[model samples]
Target: MGIGEGEPHPAGSGSSSVEVVDVLRRGELVVLGRIPSASNATLVCDVVLDDVELRCVYKPVRGEVPLWDFPDGTLAGREVASYLISDALGWGVIPETVLRDGPVGFGMVQRWVDTPDNTDRPHPSAPSELPDGRVDLVDLCPPGAVPVGYRAVLRAFDSIGEPVVLVHADDPRLQRMAVLDVILNNADRKGGHVLEGLDGGVYGIDHGICLHSEDKLRTVLWGWAGETVPAHLVADLADLARRLESPDDDLRSDLAEHITGDEIDALALRTLVIAETTAMPLPPGHRPIPWPPF
Candidate 1:
């Protein structure tokens, strides 16, 4: 969803990343406005710390709608877990997110990111209808709209029977975020959840339906599907795999508070498999891509 109306909130108010994280973990939250969106109830709010205001997204556990596939009341925790994984990889692909008590109860709060205007921003689930009404670009555009070395990862036709090209498999940020989704077993990585910061950082959000033990991965980021994984990415996965296996690892301990032990085991297994194969595995005959791939 597009950002709510009002002045945009700057993310870095001269506070170090550590200090910002601390505020998200302990500050008092004041509701700014409701961001209307499809799937979940997300709120735009201010985290107050010693009179300084930090904008954030607040997702209360009580606001979560029940899903048949996912365990109830765990979405908020999963969001924080996703952030932890991103930090561990040193990818900074997810905005700083933390779990803390809010006005309603415990929930997930993530630092707000600054994105460009609607017309220029790209969404994973949104398609841009060409003026001719013949083609719809799903997460891509004409050659001129993107930079060189951008791979035409997907090709398809719109409803009006026109051809289209889905490019940008070479975007390093997107590539890393896609790998993060796989490791989390993210079941709903919609196009709209990808946000771009003013500083040029790409951030992935809405990870409520992730980290389940079951194989319910669904996303629009299959441009690199079945491609040989890069060595550096594999090394990151290897590190996560080793950490998940260690009994004394704090990450595992932290994750246990949010997900089932079996789910944690499944996450570890996924990391090991991805590292060993060194390739992005294709979906096992199930519906792989999300509908209306943006």
Candidate 2:
């Protein structure tokens, strides 16, 4: 069956946020198949609750690949934490996600996003002759020929030793996602993780390795580094900072369930720093970008 078949309700399809959360929380889950490309055991599933049915990605805690830096089996909770942070900021960059019991055990279930088909277009990592025709978030173009409305991030040689430049669209939607990544301390923002939904929404997914205590903001979206954060986003960040400062704030209490107290404090600090500066950050550390960017 195709992704989200059988009249699956697409996210942002006029369903109230509360209603969507209720369906995901109460739905009976059936594993459809495994997404082989994922490093973890990511399962595509059909979630049903009475007449409402939705397609979702399920990542059971038992299926998580252990990481030395992060505590074991916490990736599922991190995924949910990332969604909470995104929702609190009112950016809606991440799809609706919740942590609950699934077929395999406790895991994260996120609404599946349907991206635009770009199979015929050149892969984002390979140099594209038609830069203007690019539909994805990241692209490679001939050096010194960056497409209009695109920002050049790096100039390097391709596999055949031909010079090329890495670039991403200078889109407001993408810019907002970049800011959200900064707030979440997202360690992996590969080009492939960015999606343009059919509903005219730009989304970021695969947030299993995010919201660490340290500064590990690796991504391919450094196109706007050192630039001023948009005024609206700055305002939102300021609001989020205020909420995080409250000990009994619902957002803070919800996030506390997933991440450690230190990690939450780190999150609050990151939000405050950006809100105060209102400037986009230049990448820190030697390994600022993720390998195989697409």
Candidate 3:
């Protein structure tokens, strides 16, 4: 069906992960609308199976904008790869994402997360601030007024030259996401990408520019820098490292389809470093945080 032609489908609720993946992989996609502010063409769609329908985000490869640092049309694959890694790590940080054919073309389709403040189809001008005092991983505060459970990352001025401090929550869920970003070499982890689901789960999204072989880790989640990685997370990293060691390993083989062998090797190396060192690495490179840090 044509874009904007269908009634908004309430996103399916309480589906198992396997069911979500199946619907995303085999369902018929009907475009509801476009996420106008997205750098790439991002469509909010309804994926319909025989008796189930779910809202999902579809990023078609044909709509990808070429980037100098990343190869063309690979962003969709990278998104799926990020989901694979998150699934393997048993973190569920990223939503259920799959690369599949849609109305536009082949692309990455991810289950839509229902957040407390967002509607079925989010608009370009949707409020960035979470309602009900729900804390975001990254936030801005007046200089020297950092919240009790937050870590100050950068001190700067806002557009009107008002002093502000960039900070992130000290919650462990966000810390796990930071570690995942390190292993994925995620180039963009803007504050807006972190979502607080209505189901009380914290999720990270927009992982199109991840899994690069280089040290392109740019994020607003520097709160845990220089701290020892939590023992439970380190053990998970160690498990991931072991899975990536063998050529016949399922995770390694699955990753090789989306990213290069060198990139997968780099992922393995990063996982091993964190698993062994058990410490969060300090920000590397001149620009450690992404521009506009949201």
lDDT top scorer: 3
lDDT of 3 by residue, 77-96 (tens): 99999999999999999999
- Mark the regions of model 2 whose C-alpha exceeds 4 Å error after superposition: 1-12, 118-133
lDDT tens per residue, model 2, 76-147: 899999999999888889999999999889999998776556324333223324355664568788987888
Candidates in order, TM-scores: namely 0.83, 0.90, 0.93
Clash numbers, per candidate: 6, 0, 0
Q: Candidate 3: lDDT of 131?
A: 63
| RMSD of every prediction | 5.6, 4.2, 3.3
Note the residue pairs that clash in candidate 3.
Answer: none
Residue-wise lDDT of candidate 1 within 1-294, one digit each (tens)?
A: 223455334346466778889888887798866766556778777787654568788999999999888878989989988888888878888888999889888899999886654334343234444355322212556544544555665567766766766664467788888888999998887666776666777888888989999898987777788988889999999999999999899999988888889999999999899999999978656767666655
Q: What would the TM-score be for candidate 2 when compared with the true structure?
A: 0.90
Q: Which candidate order results from sorting by TM-score in descending order?
A: 3, 2, 1
Kindly report which residue pairs in candidate 1 clash with one another: 124-191, 124-294, 125-191, 125-294, 126-294, 139-294
